[model samples]
Target chain A: MEVTINNIRKEFERFPALNDVSLKIASGELIALLGPSGSGKTTLLRLIAGLDFPTGGQIFFGDEDASHHSVQERNVGFVFQHYALFRHMTVAENIGFGLKVRPSSSRPPKSEIRRRVSDLLDMVQLGGLEKRYPNQLSGGQRQRVALARAMAIEPRILLLDEPFGALDAKVRKELRRWLREFHDRTGHTTVFVTHDQEEALELADRVVVMSQGKIEQVGSADDVYDRPGSPFVFSFIGESSHLPVEVKEKTVFFQGQPIGISEAAAGGGELFFRPEDISLVEAQDALFGKVTACRRLAGTRIAEIDIANDGHAPYHVEVEVPLHAPVALGSEVRFRPTRWKVFENA
Target chain B: MSDKARTSNPAFRDPADEGFATKVALLLLSLAFLIFFLFLPLLSVFVEAFREGWGAYYEALAEPDAAAAIRLTLLVAAIAVPLNLVFGLCASWAIAKFEFKGKAFLITLIDLPFSISPVISGLVYVLLFGSGSLLGPLLKSWGIEILFAVPGIVLATVFVTFPFVARELIPLMQDQGSGDEEAALSLGASGWQTFRFVTLPNIKWGLLYGVLLCNARAMGEFGAVSVVSGRIRGLTNTMPLHVEILYNEYNMVAAFAVASLLALLALVTLALKTLLELRFGAGNAGGRH
Candidate 1:
């Protein structure tokens, strides 16, 4: 269902967790709330789930004002980070909990509940494990069971708080792919919270980047990665080296030396470029530096260069060259920024 | 091995030869004290109870007063344990799951009876239910003799054992937090349903432990029961009061007999506690779920 959060704010005693933030999540769209620890992503998700109330805001679930609604009335499915499954119940019983608790008039029959549970187990790729308790299952299996249990009620929205965070690396990767496929097949409006940017980019159709209890940027995976709106997003979304650049009459200078800016039309701004965007050249008209360290990264040699120009602070720059390139440590190298973006630093 | 080699090898040396005699002596002394001060008295009680064979034991058990006392004690336990279980669950739920003003004071109040002497706890009830108290006239008007009756005995036992269950459950429930309940709530489970399905199952083991402890304390409560029960025969007297009466009447065999029952109950509680720890693991007590 469509969710509209208007001027939502949350506070813990004197500390504000969510600072008047607002966003709209269209129905059937999978979104990821991405942030570092204490960034209010989980708090926002909880507010949307009605597990917590916003200090000041109006939450609308398809024209129904859900600001004062309890979690039970919200009809939202939530998956916890640790997969808080009922240890006392078997997988089948856990999955069938929502159906069992439904009002008698709307409750499914025993056979239908069983069939639905089995169908959910199949959907989550846990077809034959209905008899197993949560403790008896593996971490990934327990997470999948949690997911299946959440989906049993056919909730209007699914909220996952770092669902695959507790799994090992291999299992995390596998679950990420599996979650993408599951979302595609189910087409349920889902919002998951995570601090891992890679998981957000790999899984979410839209990523909501949060910082300091505020939304920094929200966009598609490619939009966020290729065009970060803020410096925090630029640094948080991907790896990049930010070097101080002086703009004089539309000409950018690095380390007190003239740098190539023929393509950069910005008059005066700080230059930001990814390591892969910088090219190591043999000729001049580029910022001069000396190679300090070289490391092989996936068939590419990443050379760390330290600029050595007077009247300029020494800055470390990374350049990606071919694996067979003859780049040696402590050797003089000329580098030029290729694809770069300029931002006004406040 | 040569003597020099044995001396060089610390592992091969006798503890006595290694000059650990003082430590060994201290250890043995403490063990002897423990056996004499603790186990010996326990063993003596058991031996005295069964000394005249099962004949005297059966004779003591056949007494109407003894039967009444045992029944009253069980009745009190039945009333007290379940009441305390409900109270403990509610109190722990409030204290552990919710934050509000005076929370620290409420926690301290819950633990007050544990630190206060049982006699003082009984006195508090007596002060409330005695002839001159506020509710005394109303109770007397209704022909209720709570000060020196079965109700008084139950009240005292309940008072002294009030903290047992809640104390056991608070830390456990607190550590569990609101995560599972929140998950259940978001999944459309109502408050009672969430409690029954998610919250109760998570804390069931802890609740069981608390109930067991509360039951034990309620059954064996003597000081508080004696204060308020008035030590009447076959009327208000409980097991502990009956034991005291038999002992004072110079009926050592019967007195020890009743004491042995209580000791057995304590022993069973200890065993149950150990078995619970072994089966569930000590870490489970933290309520990680």
Candidate 2:
């Protein structure tokens, strides 16, 4: 189901949690609401699930305005970080709960419910653990049960809040791949909240980067990674460094000299580029920063350099170089960004 | 320097480890205190009750007024406990699962019965429903008898036992959280269905724990019931009040016999609580689900 969020604003007392946020999630697409803690990503997900109501605005499920609908009315499957499975119920019972609780007229037969539960258990790869209680299963197994339980309802949209947050790193990676495949198989309009940028980038078709209760940027993985729209996005999404420079006549200047970079914007601005996007240059006009430290990361040598800013504070940036390069502490290397974006300072 | 210091410091021990002498002293002190204050008094109740032999004990318990008091006590508990169980579940569910205005004030109000003297608790009810109070005349005009009757005794018992169930459940439910309930709702379960299938089962153990305590308090309540019961023989006197009346009349054997029944109830409560804690870990009270 397609979801349209129209100027949703939520407040707790006088503190605004989501500030007039708006977005449209297409049908059968996987979206990630990615942000740090307290960034309103979870709040926005809750609003979409109808677990919370916005202070002002509307949400439409397809063509229906469901702003005031309860979670039960919304028919959206939700999975929590802690896998909030009913501890007392067996796996089969948990999976069958939503079907069993339906109004009698629409409820499936007892045998049908059992068959469906069995099918769901099989689909989640827990085929014979039907009698196991939630506590009896491993963390990953319990989360799979939670997902199967959620899918039993056949919801129009699926929502997950840090579904893999409580698992160990290995299990989390496994679940991330499994969830992506699961989403493909089910083809449900899925939206998940996450703080891990890599998880968002890897698992989502589109990533919505949020900060301070507002949407910073919404785009595909490459769009967010290579072409961030804002400074926050640039610093938040990947390993990037920024240098404060002035732009005059479309030429970027540092320390009263043009540093061989040009931009459309005029006046002072910050230039942001990835560590691997720069290369060592022998040009005299290139910024030759003193290497303060060097370290090996995943077979690549990364040197932390500090450029003296004439009379102002020096700027620190990390530049990736060849493993055999002579980049050492206290040595100076001249480098220029191969590709960079300049954001005019406000 | 460290090797020499370590060799010389043979008497040194871990700071967390208590000295043998200190441990022995603490154990002895607590054991002595328990024997004097708790075990002795409890032992005395049984000793005094059975002093006149088992025949007299049976005779005392079988007396008309004694039987009446026992029945009344059971009846009051029967009515009060279930009422408090429902109220406690609702109150704790509200307090633990949701945020609202005046919540702290509501919690403090729930604890009011525990803080005030039981006599005051009973008096407050009397003031609300007694013959001379504002509602008393209105209730009388409607021919309802609450004060000095079974209802009054039940009310007093309910008042004193009100906080037990809610106190046991608030922390447990809070620890368990609303995650399960929200998950259920998002899976298309209605509010009632979510509570029935998810919330209720999660809290069942803690609920029973609370009910056990509430039952004990309702059966043994004295100070509050005493003031409101008017001490009417057979009609309003509970087991505890009957024991007091028997003692006041110098019916030592009967008083002790009745007192032993209340003691038995307390022991049963403790046994059941311990059994619950054993079957379901004590952490079940916190419900770490």
Candidate 3:
């Protein structure tokens, strides 16, 4: 089902948790709400799941306004960060809980519930472990059981709050791949909350980046990464270096000297570029800085460059160079940003 | 020298280990304290009851007043425990699962029975329901007896034992959290269903631990029950009150016999508690998530 969030505002004791957040999720789309802790990504996911109500908003599951509806009425499958598997119950019992708890008139027969539970276990790849309690299973297995339990209801939408967050790195990667495949196969309109940028970028069809209760940007992974709409997104999504600079007409200047770039908006602003977007230039007037530190990462060297600004603190930026590049401590390297954007100071 | 001591003794202590004398002294001190304060009193109760022989013990327990006391105690516990259990479940659920105004005040009220002396708890009931008070005369006019009746006894017992179950459950339920209930709700379960299937099972062990404690206190309560029961023989006399009355009347064998029964109940409670702790680990009951 397509999920629509219209002007959602949530406050905890007058402290805004999510302010005027709005988004539309297409049917069968896997969207990720990505942000750091306290950024309201989890709050948004909870709001969509009907675990919480928005102070001011309308949420539509398909065409129905479900803002004030209880989670039971919404019929959304929510997976908590801790899995929240019923620890006292067997895997089969946990999966069958939702069906069994239904009113008798609409409840499925016992055999049918059992069959569905078995099928769900099989789908989650834990078919024969039905009798095992949650504590008996590994973290990844428990999370899969939690997912199977959520899916047993065949909910309108699947909402996960850091579903793989409790697992170790290797398990996290494996579950990320497994979740993507599972989403493809089931194709339930899924919205997941995550702080790991890599997980969101790799698994989500569309990523909604939020910070401090407001959405910074929403786009596909490439769009957000390559064309960030705000300074926050540009710095948050990936490795980027920024410098205080002035823009005159279309030319960008640092410390009153032109750096040969003439495509900037006319204003004083901060210039942002990826660490790898700059190249070594022998030009005397090229924007340059002194290398204060160097560190080897993977097969490349990242040099920390400190640029002196006029009557202000020195600006620090990182430049990625080949492992064998002649970069050293205190060495002045002349270079310019091949690709950069200037966001006027606000 | 330390190396030589280690070689000679073959028991060199690590830095974390306390000195031998200190360890032995502390162990001996705790053992002595337990023996003096706990074991000795328990042994004396059983020893005193059997002093005049098992025949005397059986005769004393079979006495009409003692039998009536036992029955009254059982009835009081039966009435008070279940009520407190229900109240405790609701109270802890509200305190732990939801945020609301006056929560801290409600918690303090629940703990009122625990902090105040049991005598004061009983006196509070007296002041409220005693014949001199406002409602007592009104209740009497309605042809109802409360101050010196079974109702008053039950009220005092319930008041005294109110916090047992909730106190046991609040911290435990708080630790377990409301995540499971939320998950159940998200999957189409109603509030009642969520509580019945998810929250209840999550706190079952803690609930049982609380109920066990509440039952023990309800059965053994003396000061609270005494203040309201009027000590009527064969009528309002509970086990603890009967023991005191027998002791005061110079019925030594009968008093100790009844006291022994109370001690037995206490022992049984302790055994069950240990069994539960062994079965479900200590301090929050049921294994930590």
Candidate 4:
């Protein structure tokens, strides 16, 4: 079902968690709320789930006003970061808990509950292990059981608060892929909160970038990654290095030397670009600098360059080349910016 | 190099070294203290209970007053423990799950009995129920004898043990936040159902531990029951009171016999505490969320 959060605001004592934020989530859309720690992403998700009430705002599920509804009335499935599985319950019992708890008018038959539980377990790929307890299962398996339990009641919207956040790195990657597939198969409107940029970029149909209790930008993965609306989005989404540049007339000068601008220099601003965007070139559009350090990474060698400019602090630049690339410390080289964006310093 | 000599190298020694001989010596000293202070007294009680073999046990069991005292103690426990359980659950739920003005004050009120002497608790009830107090006339008008009656004893026991279960449950419930309850609520469970299925199951062990503690204390209570119970033979007299009456009347054997029974109850209490720890230890339950 479509969900709308209108001017939602929450205050914890003196600090504001959500500052009059509004967002519309389309029906059956999988949206990711992406931000760093303390960005209020999880708070927004809790408000939608009705686990928490906004200090001042309204929430709507479709045409119905759900602002005053209790968590039970909201009918949204929430999977917590730690899974929060009942340690005392078996997998089958946990999956069937929602169905069993339904009121008499809405309760399913015993056979139906059993059938649905089995179906959900199979959907999450834990079919044969229905009798197992949470502690008996692996971290990834427990997360899957949590997902199945959330889906058992056929909630209109599914909410995941860092579902794979507690797993190891390899398992996290695997679960992210499986979660995306599950979302696709069910076509359930889902909102998952995460501070992991890679997860947001890889899995979400729409990424909502939040900063300081406000939506910085909301777009598709490519839209937010390639064309960030603000410097916060640019710096938060991917690894980027900053280069100081002074805009003189229509030309941008890097360290007092005139450097070619992609277009007209808009004025004095900070240049933001990814390390992968900058290339090590022998000449052309070159900003001369000295290599301060070099290190070998997993598949690439990274070199740190200090671009010396007069009257200004040395610009720190990182360049990633092939592992086989020949480079040494204190080596002089001419570097160029392949792709860059300018932002006014805040 | 020989294996022992090679292993003795300082570089190969443990970085987190603890002297083995010192640890062994400390452990032995602790065991000696436990035997001398705890097990020795318990052994003495057991030996004294069976001093004249099964004859003394049967003689003690056959006494009408002894049987009446045992029944009275059990009845008091039955009334006190369940009431304390309900009160403790509510008090702990309020203190742990909700925050309000004067919450700390309410917690201190719950712990008042634990800090104050048990004799003081019994005296407070006696003052409220005796002939000199305001309610005494009203109770007398209704033909209620609370000062030296079963109800008086039960009330005093309840007051003395009120904090046991709540004390056990508050930290557990507080540590296990309202996350699971919220999850169950979101899953379409009503408030009562959520409490019955989710909250109760999580705290059941802690509740049981508290109830056992309350029961043991109520059964063996001496100081509080002695003050309020007037020690009427086969009437208001409980086991502890009976023990005192038998001893004062120069019935040393019967007094020792009843004291030994109360000592047995104390032993069972220690055993129950140990089992409770093993069954529902810190690592086994609570703190899930």
What TM-score quantifies how close candidate 1 is to the native fold? Answer: 0.89
List the lowest-lDDT window of 10 residues for candidate 2 chain A.
A320-329
Off by over 4 Å in 4: A244-248, A254-257, A262-268, A279-288, A297-300, A308-313, A321-327, B1-40, B46-56, B59-64, B99-106, B127-145, B281-289
lDDT of 1 by residue, B104-222 (tens): 99889999988989899888888999988999888899998898898888888877888988998899889888877877777777799999988887877777788888988999998
Query: Interface RMSD computed for candidate 3 is what?
Result: 2.9
Docking class of 2: medium
Q: What local lDDT does model 1 show for residue B96? A: 91
DockQ, computed on Cα atoms, for candidate 2: 0.57
- Grade the docking of candidate 4: acceptable
Q: Tell me how far the alpha carbon of residue A280 in candidate 4 is from the true structure, in angstroms, after superposition.
A: 4.9
Model 3 bad stretches (over 4 Å):
A310-312, B1-12, B282-289
The runs of at least 3 residues in candidate 1 whose Cα sits more than 4 Å from the true structure, single-residue gaps closed, are A254-258, A262-269, A282-285, A308-314, B1-35, B131-144, B282-289
Name the 10 consecutive residues with the lowest summed lDDT in model 4 chain A: A257-266
Error of 1 at B220 (Å): 1.2
Best by DockQ: 3
Counted clashes in each candidate structure = 0, 0, 0, 0
For model 4 the local lDDT of residue A117 reads 95
- Please list the C-alpha lDDT of all candidates, in the order they appear: 0.87, 0.91, 0.90, 0.86
Tell me the interface RMSD of every candidate, in Å.
3.7, 3.3, 2.9, 3.8
Clashing pairs in 1: none
lDDT of 1 at A77: 86
The candidate, 1 or 4, that scores higher on DockQ is: 1
